[model samples]
Target chain A: MGWFSWGNKNQDISEPSRQNRQKCWETRDSYFDCLDRANIIKPGDEGNSCAKEKQLYEDNCAKSWITYFNQRRVLADAQKDRLAQAQAQADSARK
Target chain B: MREVSHFVTLMFSQRALASLARRTYVGGQQTARHGRRNFSQTLKRQSQFGKDRNTIGTLTPASAAVFVATGVGLYFYFRYEKQKLLEEREKERSSRQYGRPQIGGPFSLTRSTGETFTEKDLLGKWSLVYFGFTNCPDICPAELDKVGTILNKLEPALGKTFLPVFISVDPARDTPERVGRYLADFHPAFVGLVGTYEAIKGACKAYRVYFSTPPNADPQGDYLVDHSIFVYLMDPEGQFVEAFGQNTEADQIAARITEEVARYGK
Candidate 1:
């Protein structure tokens, strides 16, 4: 059921936002890696010691990525619609 | 013997005895034998009566209480076992080929009226949910139409126990107002939902829906969104009951749902 991911790609994002998002994702990844090394399947909540890096990533980069991802999706949708209309117009002219 | 003779003479006169003698006369030995037989019979009858009393007297109150309690307990225990077996058989009879999948969970989206719609809103009624964008070229429109027809047929049989819901997969273009306009062309009772990309994605994931990037789209936004097309039926408890594929006809869906609702209440 995981056919597509919401966090797949945001190529059109600004350089700084992209860097920030990457850094946050990396930080979260590193925390998960640490958990893996420690043989922990799931990290503890805010009160637990293992959540510090993950919390940092959530606070710094996750919000920006969410916004960028949504913007990209909307723009892509608009582009698709424009293409369909152009094709429709061409077909009508030929007819 | 002399005393007995005197009593008998007093009771019956000589003339009467003489007349009785003409009918039949009991000799002394015969009379004694008859008396002994009567005495032995009376003693045996008394002993049998006494034995019956002794048996009844042995049944104390504690033992009587135990006897009554055991009788009642066994009766209810057997009844419970019979009911349990019946329920198991019913479950086996109703077992489905599409085993229960963990589909559906909490989701928050905006209704057509600019109100927040959550999973709680789906409670207390049966719901038929389909995921697609309003701008879908053919499949979405066709499926929605079929759903509308099914709803119309279902209404006569099920009344208002069923709800039809359309959740947008392409939330970017399907605003609440746009969704509302799209649904207006279908069933009047249909509810349209639109939300942020994350919210819509979460809802789709929960329902095991598949959708990917639009195919063959130009720079302009006119392409069709590709997504899985199925109408999901939910029970009153917001659990998944079944899903109907694209080829299923409206009447087929209606009949199946009518049977389902009759067998298991909304």
Candidate 2:
């Protein structure tokens, strides 16, 4: 659900940590900036601006954004997996 | 509060034991330990502080250690319960959580129709709310895909009953038209929302969500937003019923949402 909904408190993405928050913010900004640059460079309202070519630019930007997030998502998943393994090891050691 | 009660119980029981010891020492039932009255008074003050949220009550060394662990356990338990309740409540905000209905604030947001949508509009309908920008690279699309999957799954059971909503965080570029086109890729059933920066900020604040621009090492750049990711379920009558996280399975989410619809008498 969006931020306004209930049941959101338990989300791992909702966890408050300086590093995670910073990383999210940083990555998002860099990606968006890339888009803005693309947005600016997109052929303007001039009659000669090619519609199909402008779409090509937009599509490329969208793909780049997807790639960045997918890489980040993979890293995040790996980190969680590593953490779970460490916790399991600790539990066994305690036992 | 629970912690304080447990401590008070421990202290009282310990006092009873001390009194018994004193009775044996003096060979009389009326006898008391030295400074017993003062110790009891101290505990009373401690409990009061706990009630005020100014201090946490402590127990004897061993008891405190065990109690501390339990307190930690309880904290996590309550957090988990609250999350579940939030999701359930959003599923039936006007209906109930794991418990009873709780009131949420009434707020106004403009939808893609260029019409101002308020909490009132959300009432009498189940809304699956998502937050992201049209420029979002990954999470937003993934989440929206999940939404599409969920809608496809639940449409037969909940046709025209549930509403999927997308609210844009990047107002700098995500106009109503942009959000509309973006959501169209996911589901025709999706409703797009975009408003002034202040308007979106107010809603986010009410929800205790954090979204901020990443500090840039460079000067000229359009920043991205870091926001909470969950699909909020707002029940008929505009109460937050439930929410799902980034990885919540689509079928599971649709099931819970459907269950809420039936259980809430809506």
Candidate 3:
């Protein structure tokens, strides 16, 4: 399809190149995987087709997952501080 | 300017859509006198493509297979070796980054098994310690998972010498039994320790941890404990080896732990 579209120079202004544009569509599979994992794109998820479910997930799930990863870092830092203090105390007692 | 650049990169060279016009221009069939020869040549070329292109005009399936296989083989092999290299790299990374002992002072705790575990236990072997509660929802679960990943990454090398301990902050609820059950979610070798409030407080204070119950009490009378997330790595000498950041990926943590153990002779 990209090969055919390559010669169609008169295509719409908003249209992306067709060469390796198929590669960008690779995210489509993972998008569906994400939706399936989140349980938002099931056999009965309202009227959402694969495209809509994928779009919704790309909009929402991607951000939330990032937030989840970020929060876990803060949690680690707090724990590190507490543990580091214990280490300091032990060092002092050793002296 | 950015839009133009984006348009150029995305619309033009990206898809190679512009390149297709050059290929078909080799001469359309309408311009040919030997139209049958042109069609025959195209069909032969197409069939030759099916059989193998690299073989005919730098198009051989054997060579292509060798080429593609080289790519795919390199891909899978790199994935294979990459996994091993990553493991080796991880092993190297852990050894390199496993800096400084995390346990410095007192780390005394009364275990559910009726044994008192102190820094002395950490002195003779490598230890992976965690300060979390069974009740914690997100933070605790994530940290424990990290500890499990780190241990799994280390246990292979450190063997039985690697000790992964989970000390409960909410001792009242995290009884020995609950701790046992909670360990099920992580590495089996995970040691679950529960003590009285004082013993736990002493341990947490020794570790410099702070935890407060949620301001809004559990409406159903169930309490929520908000605690920090960190996996404490203690050296064989029971000194603080290093503490990994919460956001640190599991592989990195494992790499660090492995590095420290190798340094400490784990």
Candidate 4:
């Protein structure tokens, strides 16, 4: 009964604390850095390269956060490409 | 010299009367030759009586100038009045648009303290309502922090008359207790609300908030719910006054709310 109560308490306190969130962000950054070193624009593409870092990130952060971060990483890269293309077009137009 | 000026004025008056008679006679469609003979008789009579053709010539030009000036003045006067009327109408239309925004309506949800809260609860106080989930990693926290800053800035002067509310879009994962605990990290004055999926959907619809948390999604599953991030300002009467986007500065929002509160008092 005590074990069940403890589990209930854990379920009730679902949101991460401030320190836990910081830890999650740290792990996420480390994992993303590994992915960047591997030249992988997409997160899931680096299968075995950053497995340890990915495990740490998954354990620290919530599932929803992980999904959001992965999607945002890809989106940010795409946005960079678009901005570069726009800059090149602007330069050519100026000439 | 005065006698001579008076005589010239009398002569001009006589000439005006003669022209009036000629116009009336022409209106009757009399013979063209008869009209010409009458004009010649008047001219002969004028020449015999005064022999001052120079006075008549000069007076004609002066009267013509006065007539043209009066016509132009009337034209501009009417145009100015028309322009003023159009501007007044535009002002009234804009006031009507801003005075009564159709943003909020009937909604029911559970407050963080396990009490029933409805749109009626929003009445009698200015409320800042935001729609977000506790699981939002970065944006929601940043926005809530901004709201906290605004509340802290306004609380001293506006105290109790102002309320900040957070409504959870992710009902499946965010229970009232969880939402309450999450909001404790921000301003204590905040009223966190959560409800069943249908109730949350109705509330979102009432506020015109677009959230993408699917019904029947696994509560334990890891997925992000995309939603609109706008903080709505409602007047004491529960009518929406404005919606502040994510980029709006806390100072700007505070200034706006202070202005609105003053205006409402009036």
Better of 3 and 4 by TM-score: 4
Candidate 2 C-alpha lDDT tens digits along A1-95: 22112123532222112233334456445544454455432224223334444343333333334355546645766798899999999999999
Off by over 4 Å in 1: A1-95, B1-88, B91-98, B213-220
What would the per-residue lDDT of candidate 4 be over residues B3-78, giving only the tens digit for each residue? 4455557656655765654445435644334335666576555456443443533245666787567556656766
lDDT string for model 3 (B1-266, tens) is 34334544553342233123223323353343333454445544554444432233333456446555545544565557657877887888678556643444675666656577776766677777788876553566667777777667766666777778888877555667667766776677777787777777777777777776443333223345566566777777677867777889989887777666666663
DockQ of each: 0.01, 0.04, 0.01, 0.28
Q: Residue B218 in candidate 3 has what lDDT?
A: 33
Q: How accurate is candidate 3 locally (lDDT)?
A: 0.58
Estimate, for each residue in B1-266, the C-alpha lDDT of model 2 and write its tens digit.
46556765875676566434433433433333443676545444543554422222233566567767866777777778889988986888644355733423555777877889766776777888887875565577789889989888888877777788887776555666656656767798888877777877766665555666432312122334678888888888777877789878998998898788888884
Docking class of 1: incorrect
lDDT of 1 by residue, B84-182 (tens): 999998787667524687888889999987999988899988899999875453467779889989988888867988889999877555667768877
What's model 2's lDDT at B43? 44
Name model 2 segments beyond 4 Å from true.
A1-59, A62-95, B1-104, B214-222
- TM-score, predicted candidate 3 vs. hidden true structure: 0.44
Reproduced native contacts, each prediction: 0.00, 0.04, 0.00, 0.48
Model 4 DockQ reads 0.28
Tell me the TM-score of each prediction against the true structure: 0.48, 0.51, 0.44, 0.68
lDDT of 1 by residue, A1-95 (tens): 01112244542222122234346557666765665566654345224655676566455443434344335545766788899999999999999
